[model samples]
Target chain A: MSLILKGFGKVLKNKEILAPINLTIKVNEIVAIQADMEHMNAFLSLVEGKRSYITNEIMMNEQSLQGCEDLFIYRPDMGEYKRLTPEQCIQFWCDLYKVKINIDNVLALTELTHIRNKKNKHLTFSEKKRLQFARSLVQNTSIFIFQEPTYQLDLQSKQVFNRVLNEILKNGGIVIVFTSSLEEGVRMATKVFRLNSRGLQEVELGDEGEKEAEVKEDETDSLIENDTVYQRKFEKISAKSDDKYILFDPLEIDFVETRERQTILHVNNEEFYSTVSMKEIESKLIPYGFYRCHRSYLVNLQRVREVVVWSKNSYSLTLDKGNEQTVPLSKSRYGELKAFLNW
Target chain B: MNLRLIRVLLLKEIKDLIWNGQVAILFVTSILMILVFFTFNQLEFNLPGHSITMFKGIPTTLSFIVLLVTMYVQGNLMVEEKEQNTERLLGLIKVKYINVFISKAIVTYILSYLLFVLAMVIHGYSFENFITASFFTIPFFLMFLFLGTIIAEASSNTIEVSLYGWPIFIVYFVIEGLIYSSIESRFFYLFPNYHIERGFSLIEHGEFLAVFNYIYVPIIWMFIILFFLKKRRKNSKTILNSGFS
Candidate 1:
């Protein structure tokens, strides 16, 4: 059994947030993805069937997700409940799914049996997450999609989540977790995919040196051309210009700016419109020498040729591009900019 | 249209409504109000020839009680599921939207009617009055349930519902009461409560056709509300359009 997505794409408000992509998650495996909140919303909306995708096909239990009703389950990241006991929550799921569950086994598995009698609103934050985890366990589906499952979880509760994840994997079920933390993704996933506007791209999860050592010496230099994290396979960031699609390398872009809630990528004295938020763009291009010099501007550090001081507290970065394009520099980031440049 | 699925959802709604502390408190307060009305009737107005007409003129009082309790319990139930983010979980289950709506309405109607009957019993009314009140509240509370569900769907939380919904509903309710008792305006007759009161009056005066007038309006209102709600659910941007799960 497996959960599969072929050319899955989500578009909103006349712009595509997720490009058409392909992925396959099999039973007895866990796949984790790191994505921002908007991307998560778009993805979750598609998974829940609120919005349709373009050129997308999803299969669970060897059939389409729509055809196979009992194939997948979804759980939101937050854990506030309406005064339900842990046992009641499990029983409610059982009633909804039309299955008989041993509540004791579920509570024991999630280590929530002790609080089975306590009301949900009375539970602590961590306990509530465990109760949610236990609720998902009651549904016997092939694939489980959890949005930021480790959010607000304490260390001990995270250990409990890991244990529960292992149980699902051992029982031949696929678990897909969406998170923003790279550490959590690396710790939980057998395979990791970083979700961006372009699509899902597989990335290294375990020790960096171990994977590097496994690469052949002749191919190592070509695989990682620079010290930055941008690989050739994951370099192109998708954008649009005049009703046509365009792709720009993050390394080649001088800066990105936002105008009227629209993100515009600036490269080589040209502008391409983008749909992603500035914060999401910043996080994606941060490893490739992009710096958030101001709230509206994200400048490439490698393109910065000079720092112009407009006042005692104000500064701007002059790029090495045509006519030395200037971008605002926030007062708070001035110290980091100076320290990075050693000036 | 699966009966088994509807039954399961109904049972869950009943459980949630009964265990709610606010519902319990309102239930007890309603009983106390009935007792107070009973004690005042016995001690202060226990004169001859005052037995039949007593508590008959103010059927709206009982209607008001039922309205408040149903709105609080049913409306907040819908809003809470949305706020707690549990509606997303329900959407993945692939249950029919009609089943969820039917189950919730049935459960709300049953609980609200039971409490209305209990309050009437404590007030020590005659069988004729009891029968008239029962017939009046059936449509009365059902319309209230529809109104409450609409308000719940339009708002994000219980606080917003009370802040905006209660005033609009109360204004409509009080205006309907005025039109039923004192006004002869045609526009006021559009309020379902006006027709409900007129139906109860016809029942009181042995007009068998009251069934047609009162019954047809709420039935039509029910269909209209359900249609709009179904369209709303279909076009909703979030998964919090239904009350199930």
Candidate 2:
């Protein structure tokens, strides 16, 4: 399941806010948003689920494991609310030691409350920066871009953000933070993408600043390298969010990746409750009955419930869930769903 | 609720509320002044057209809540984002700014009215006859809030929005006073005060007030203000800079 972000850019309409003219940040890359007060809302519009002053009303309603993925970016009074204390951290670590919970689950902090207010509440500048950094670390998704992740933060918080950002990169993720001060950006980012008068450009960093991206000692790397299980688990790996992970486990996860003519079926969690890929689906369930319905979707020849006419020239596919999911019935697949499902 | 973003925005608002604590103090003081119209120094619900008087106070509280909070709170919305240069940050993450706005209004209302209610309670006022059923003032409250937010968003000078909010206050007061004096007139219908009258009349008659402010003045004015702000963003390249209030 390879997801691609085609074209994304940000343009500032104010002289008060000078941005790197135009830039494209892929998924999983941590890209920092840097600007003064005027551009904050515009930058905020990028992540908000609703229409904002910066952009149009397009929204991505998917759930992200990154803590507080749905939170508005510019709330100022957030500190006045509440937070889980340092003591809470001790308690959490104790629980983790006891349960041996996966780091991913713990990082999500699903039950997080009071710590994040639905409305704006009071917070110090440092607190906000720290939280943003933590969010970057916990998000196990495609590319991250932090726009000035270290602005107005106190010293300790800046250090913490820097550490968390490095951790994100070390975890097989990409991160890019924006800064007017090249020194700051150079210090913080691993892969710096500059968006000055020139369209978007990229720059790789040398060893400098916080070394959080490193695995601390040679032991950690050797532990994984020497472990036969870990080696066998990862073969040909590609990009991943929470939903789509490439074939990492060598033996059990054999796949053929090519831009080929073979029909590839996509199984998304939204309409496709059946988590099996088209090949797996074709083997055990819908044998002799699957086709690449669309570029981003698949259909089981045996389970399609209906083909509702979409327009004079197109149609939609309804499935076992009694839910209708659309697929362009290009003059090609019109007769496929019905004859295949035998309905 | 992302703790980071919320913390950033919330901190700024508190800084603002405190910086302009004078507005809050003045607004509350005005409410205290209205306590003069009380039937007696002591608490009593006895008076001819008692419902009428009580009905009017409902919108008054809402409008004042909207007015004063707007005076101090409107600038706190997307203003800082416009200033600190982070709106595009918000856009990139795909945040819901309206929720931020609504949440901000809610917090402001809760804090302001918490104090207002405490003042009322301290003075032996009773919630028993409060606007339990009438919702007329709700639209008026929302209209004021949305319109005020729009003005704050579009203001040329950021400092003037908070320091000299009297212009906004004066316009609202004049409109409210005229509408209040002629509740029966069609002119007041546009004032949101008219809706307050209707809602209060129903509450006085013991009817259900609506639950959706989204359907009332709040919703209408919210869309109106949002439209203008969006329009301004499109019409002028400097629109985003002007929003830094």
Candidate 3:
């Protein structure tokens, strides 16, 4: 099934809030749209048929979306009954949809089985989000729309969300995520689009060949002085965990940072002390999409998700690893990084 | 129209009411008000025939309790749903808004009826009259439910519910006073509480036809309040709309 939007746009009080958006989403396809909060809310309102738009229409599988809203399950950022337990919340959704799904399975899928009996008000921020996800899962709708699915969530909760998304795709359901974070959009969806006053535009993530060519160009200039050029082989960075030396592929490392004069390698969610200095490691991993974002921080460019700007002088790089690791970005390096990314 | 969905929605409403401490307090207060009114009726008076009979005072007491229970309970339910945004969630799940309305109304009606029966038993009223009173008071119960819905739709939270609800409730008694006084105005007939009082007085006199005559007024008020509810529901904005604006 394909969901198509034909020139969907909104104008409030003669002021353009959202530009016309034309797009098509198909079954088993996950789409993420990145926009500022104002445009995001307006776009979501237009899609949910809550706000009247000046132009365009939405159709799902050749049928108008006006009366077929049941086919869409929208999980807003926050809207669960605080008094109800996770199990009760899921059961309520199941009964409302008039479907008999396995409540236990849903609870398990959301990793909420342990807290199934606890009231939602008592749940932590991540658990409440999981409860909301479970509620959406039980509806068994063909289209799932989530707003900031992983906002302020822990690593485990993000993993649970990833599994839930896979389950929906495996069931042949279409998923659309609307987020203000570009990193979240790229991390959660296969096809990511940026929406703003300019209209909807697809963000082209370069192919493997293009990335390899860029890396090769950088490597050629640096290696020209070496008389004996050796064929590249699989390389791994070595770090010491207690007395044992562990070898990790460069791609496995989220970032490298020096703490108290000790170079540390962060992989997954674990920290390992690297015997090599930060400068040496940075030079070796440069061909593998690594960037020295800060004086003491070498971040894997492939794992960098967001460049968060707190103020004119304060900036940070959020990594796409578990728990969303962040490293400080020096002001001097910020311009170079931006220019490299062509942003 | 979906019975299963309605049942589920009813169960949710019942659970919500049970967990809400404020509603529980109001419920307990209603019971206490009945007992207090009953005690006042039993005490002897110095003036002969000046003492009120339990039968005569119970209907008035029950009417006030019905107004309190139905309006507070129904209004609390709707406002809480709107405040917490579960109403939007239910809409997303495609649960018909009418089913939710029916569920909340049923719960409020049941609570009001229970309070009425309890008040009758405390005052030693007969079961025959209990059935008659309950049947005749159907329109008033519905009127209160619709009024509660209107108050909730107009407010965003419990604080606002009381802001809008209590004044309208106090006005019911004020209208009742005007109906009993020398004031001869047709506007007093427009209030449902006025018709409710007239119908109760007719029932006391065993004038069933006159009771039916007053019944049409409250019934008309019910329809009018229902129209307002429909209009409010149609124009009600979702939480996202608030963010957009």
Candidate 4:
């Protein structure tokens, strides 16, 4: 489970772009790493060097299940295919994606045509974020190491990535997917480690998205039904139709449920602003799939389509419609968004 | 994965060598030349020495040409793998690189050697002294066959193997000629082919002994080439050897 990367640090020139410290991984776990192309390439250099600390043998293999004999088929050309062996699948997604470039008359390949260099061009931010989540998964080789495996790929090829990792884990193979997405990491990982400006923080799988949303709605119903101040604020906020967000002081908030959660209403009014607690509203909204990505807002999962960079310091999302709402995407919550988005 | 697999890979390499259109054509042409020489009992040569029995001329002249062509083919075996990404794929396998390299060399040598044997039999039958010529030639043929294989694999692939390996392989005999011509080195039995070729050539020339001596140079060349391969592997970084991210 422990990969001793000898002299790896010396070669990676830019260290500041790396995740915050305070992370630890165990055997047979999934930890996805999401980093820039340069960083991943450096990581690849280490892996190919038999840096895995395994024996010199490195077979490009897939699964070997009894019923699933022809587990994965790799297309080396448009119509040509090569079978994936048992070992390749238990490891990762490289088998399906990479096309091994070779020479015509000899075994030596051109150094210039190396595969790592080829991945650099044409990547969207979302794809890069997705990779960060994948990296975190790969690091979790602590709990589940892939046994003899195979790939079950469909057209477009990426559909089998998660299924393959899951099978490997089912048989017991550790996976670390270095990613930058919250949705991808959360979906694949049992336990996850995320990089925050506060340092490395770990998040336990809290609850299912639908169930959590339902719970929050029930809390909001109770607070609006019972509390005198909350009812007045709700009335006042409901009266003010056009205001996007109501300013509520934190000290005035009365959280009857989950401790650290906060709520920000999209209405500005004195009555509702004074009576309704941020935490109470958040707790109430939880049942509706509203999770706090920042201190000031509770985002509805169904409404959010994408987190696009608005500027250097902030990002905005064009929700379900043309609703252009800018929200602060913090480094602490960066990994979470990726997992939540499932990208 | 096992000895059986290794044997299969070895046989496959030999099959590849034997089936190659270029190698086959070169081999066939060498035999045809030998057949032509035997038909005329000798080609019109003004360079040196008498036009003795064509049976005697083959082990030297025809063997050198075939050895050169075979080595040329051997040197390019890995080139195709590099071009096709086969080496990277095969490198992932549990097999040893040395095993693959040696297997290819052995296969190339065997094919070249077999071609030489074919030419010998063809020439012997034409001369009407097949029994006597065949008797003296088999042992020498075996020795040269093994040596020719070694030399082909022994040289560096930077320049073409045929250009470098063949000339150097044949030069060992030419050096023997320079020494054998001198009274100072009348006891030139050191060259494996020198004595065998000379032994038969004195009474009646036969090219078999000279071909046998030609094999020694290549045998020594194989060991030398193996040494260089060992040095390269030893010097490279582990990252340099296999996967590079």
Predicted model with the maximum DockQ: 3
Q: What is the interface RMSD of each candidate, in Å?
A: 2.8, 11.6, 2.0, 10.5
Question: B7-110, model 1: which lDDT tens digit per residue?
Answer: 88777777666568866776677666666655554554546755333333334545556566676667777677677777656655666655766777786676
On lDDT, who's better, 1 or 4? Answer: 1
Candidate 2 residue-wise lDDT, A160-232, digit = tens:
6555654554565555455653334434543454453333455433232113313242345556456645423
- Estimate, for each residue in A1-343, the C-alpha lDDT of model 4 and write its tens digit: 3222222221235644333233334445666543334544444333434433343222222211221111221112111001111122112222222223222111111111222222212222322222222322333222322211111212112223454455455655655554454333444455544543233455434345434655676687777667655432322221122565444433232211221232234321122322345555565556656666644345666666667542233343334444433333443455687797778
TM-scores, all models, native as reference? 0.69, 0.42, 0.74, 0.44
Angstrom error at residue B46, model 2: 20
User: lDDT score, residue A11, model 4?
Assistant: 26
Model 4 is docked with a DockQ of 0.03
In candidate 4, residue A281 scores what lDDT? 59
The pairs that clash in candidate 3 are none
- lDDT tens readout by residue for model 2, B1-245: 44444454554455445544455665566566446433332344656766234325544654565666644555544354554444443443434455445545555655655544544454444454354522333444455455545555665444545655677678877777777663456666554545554565454444444432323654565567657765665564431222312
DockQ, candidate 2, vs. native dimer? 0.03
After superposing candidate 3, which stretches have Cα over 4 Å from the reference? A11-16, A50-57, A60-75, A206-343, B1-4, B48-56, B175-198, B201-210, B238-245
Per-prediction DockQ: 0.32, 0.03, 0.46, 0.03
Winning model by TM-score: 3
- Predictions: Cα RMSD each: 12.7, 23.7, 10.8, 14.9
Could you tell me the C-alpha RMSD of candidate 3 in Å?
A: 10.8
Please list the residue runs of candidate 4 whose C-alpha ends up more than 4 Å from where it truly belongs after superposition. A1-30, A47-156, A160-163, A177-343, B1-5, B11-56, B60-69, B89-94, B125-245
Query: Would you list the clashing residue pairs of candidate 1?
Result: none
How does each model score on lDDT? Answer: 0.69, 0.44, 0.75, 0.41
